[model samples]
Target: MEPCERARLHAYFSKIASQFAPAEPAASFLVTHLLAERPAFVRAVAAMSRLRAVLPKPKSVNAAAQREVEQAIPCDTLSRELFTDPDTALNYLESRAPGESIVLLDVGGYFTPTISELHSRFSGQILGVIEDTENGHRRYADVDKLPCPVVSVARSPLKDPEDFLVGQSVVFSTEAVMRDRGDILHGRPALVIGFGKLGSSIARLLHAKGVQVTVYDIDPVRRTQALSQGFVVARDREATLAGAGLVLCATGSLSLRGEDFPHLRNGAYVATVTSSEDELELDGLPDVYTRTAASEHVTRYQTTGHYFYLANGGNAVNFLHGASVGPFIFLVQAEILAAIRMLTRAGLAPGMHEVSANDRAAIAATWLSYFNR
Candidate 1:
């Protein structure tokens, strides 16, 4: 970690903590975090502690870093045991802190179901939920009636900058993975699946890199947006897949299923921007295809007539090389903190709500002032 970056993150964390610290610690937080040993995240966790007691449920992918965070700030033993097992995590949380007001501070909505269960099992104990990722926000949105008030910073304008930077990181990581295999991205026909914020950024960045970018989106509006932006929008998904040399899946959902794999151009490179295997459904890959290791970060799946390359073992390619979005992500993190603070107050009804615009503007202005200086 760069010293300047660490210092900036620490300063930003302090600013958020000072601004959002509750008058009285109102709720204990059950936090789902990617414990990636990133300075921005680590310091954010520390700042959350000032607001209330936080039970950090480390995403299973980064358990080693979870141990580092645990050593830095003691977490409940049960939170560690049930980190991957969501079904039991809530039960354990209830048992550990009986009658306490708990808030679900979630990433990727991994605990959405658990929060629902908590609401049903022990009503009013769950204060509210603060979701940080678009994927998670959608999960909560799908619920017919949320069990508690849910505030999300996932789609806030403050997050747009972070999403754009994440898109850049994804493409940069993909290029690095390609270079390792003696390949280049310049002038290659690439298909980008999903034309949302991150997907649009990826498509635009790829085009700027001299890659012929073809975009596909289930939403006709987004496809039109891509077309208006001057990228070729695919009318026939299979035909577009057949023509592309590279495929980047940015949709946080299962954009590519196993049945769709055969349409891919032979030796086409496929990567995802989402952290999980939600983008490419490799489990549905046909049995006809055999898998082989192409490199540390690349996997090759082949059949007699068709084959495609999976980068970063179907995980987000950006994470393969330390998904560095720099201090920009702190803006979104600060928004999540502000949401948590808002949840502590009364009068937020049960349903999905956006982080207040005032909070968003304040956080962004704070970021610009600090980074600009």
Candidate 2:
């Protein structure tokens, strides 16, 4: 976007920011910006971090699950699908269309759309990727083999896709923005609910930064492995929630005990994978209800959003933080997969990141339609 366009986008956001404060959810904010075609989103992190929400805590890592991951994860060959079919993958997403022009990216501790299915869905539309792992690249080597137009950006060019994607691209802002809210995370103790792709990524980030991290999950094996990795593991929610600063829920489970929140330090931050928003309640917390992303720090606050509904909202916490580092690999690869048959049909090239507002708007719309249906 040009300087003028960027400025106009900011103005638009300033106007709508107040109207949206009540939503207390990321999607409401993201989807709203998508609709306005205002790419320059006034990030929720910028809004919530101002208060310096004093949300912090610490705990032990879960045992059984950690041990299992330590034993099973480290040496596995991430190259092969192990046992997944590419064609079925595309079909699966086609069945779920969501009617949006999507850029498929992975979320930790959550199920992801398959490669072939994602490729088939966004044929000729995808361009770049934003990944946190080396394996993410190996899986789609064919795209990498393509020339120029298909180049991939390895580092978290938290800078801009303009470094790569130029003109009107349909992009997927995956894990990038998810873990961004530094104000919320500044001095907090953390807990990771699931250690799958999403959970593990965030846990590693927190630990690397020297924050006390505790892991919790249903898989007994994963629990043990995470512990061995040196992370403190908790036995259950009851054990993990005491005085916690931030809780990242990336699991498939829907409801967790309320006592977990009551014990949370007042003004604590709680974020989850975009997919898990409905699983837990953020309204009835012990004191002040703070709704924010793991990446961007905070999004909306239930305590202040009016008439606590226990529904704080959702954002891709993984994307929030992952964006902090980037070439925006995950969905960039997905978009490339989507554009494969169509764009690559003409010739081969490494897909780029920076996407067009039109493409993302379409994807968001389609995603909305699918979810509504």
Candidate 3:
């Protein structure tokens, strides 16, 4: 939100707006983390079409600030709480503009089911969707048939840099939260439960901090990649969890459940790096365990002789401290804008598609030129 950052973002978005024709009029729905930079991205999307409703992810931090920003834009900020339930979201969307053409811009496919339901009622009225996260992409991937064109920037090469920075932010925020409780990560045992882009980055960064990082991934290929990177790969997940002083779950799925809680080392700190609560089954905490608040961002769950800490109530710890990824995030945001532009064109096929390589290259070139200058 600095003056320089604002000016740079304005210039970048202006450049993108010039590259594509104005979007055909359609109501827009956006689901995203309400971070500081979100207002700029929202503004960029608003420029392309009519923004109907903005749904902030419940797990994302800084809702108050982002809500204030949304006041200036001509859109309704939907209830973050109600947005989670697909049926409720569908009802809200239906009530907003009945029988009108609508487009979706989502972060984690929170509206996947809502869109599916909408398609059943008003098929072609739903123009298309632009999804921005791998987590969201997987949600759409699970569907047997999509009702409209869905463009994903999740796995695009343009997102590579943003993924790297996300990992860095996770660690940075984790350290800050740990420090609040008079703890440090150096020379401690750590277990990272996923070896995907975010997991691998977290593992490497933790290892660089002198933490003995052990990695585990359900995928053999990812495990091999972790091993090749010179970090210990966990073959026995329970054993690794029992030994680590720190545990970070990077998998977007349910990486940890109630049954897995007892395996954690006593007094060990656990955290997640994904926006969804699905990453950890916190509600599944067994009757034996007693829960207590250790601090604003840390929770203590103890059972008899065993206990472990949960950071940020099992949500992404990075968001507890605002989840800043610096200016590099603009690359991915620009790609999302480009994806929205793609959705505006006629005759696009249904189902998920990668952000076009030409669009990716153009965005990357613009990013390089802006930063280099």
Best by TM-score: 3
Clashes of each: 0, 97, 0
Task: Score candidate 2 by TM-score against the native.
Answer: 0.37
Q: How far is 57's C-alpha from truth in model 1 (Å)? A: 8.4
Model 2 per-residue lDDT tens digits across residues 265-357: 554556554333334654445466555443333454445433211112443333332222222322232222232222222334454433344
**lDDT winner among the candidates?**
3
lDDT (Cα, 0-100) at 356 in candidate 2: 41
Instruction: Name the lDDT value of residue 263 in candidate 3.
Output: 88
Which lDDT values do the candidates have, in the order given?
0.77, 0.39, 0.81
TM-score of candidate 3 relative to the true fold: 0.93
Of the pair 2 and 3, which is ahead by lDDT?
3
Over the stretch 1-373, how does candidate 3's per-residue lDDT look in tens digits?
7799789888888888777534476777777787867788788777877777677776673766576656865345544345566667667777765777777888876667666667666523777888888878888888778878898988988778888888998999888889999999986699999888899899988988888999989999999999999989998989998999999998887888878888888889999998436688877779988889998889999989988888988889888777887777888888877777777774788888877788888888988888866
TM-score of structure candidate 1: 0.89
Best of the two (1, 3) by TM-score: 3
Across 236-349, the per-residue lDDT of candidate 1 in tens digits comes to 999999999999998888888988989988878999986545677788888888989998889899999887899977778887766767667778888877876787774789
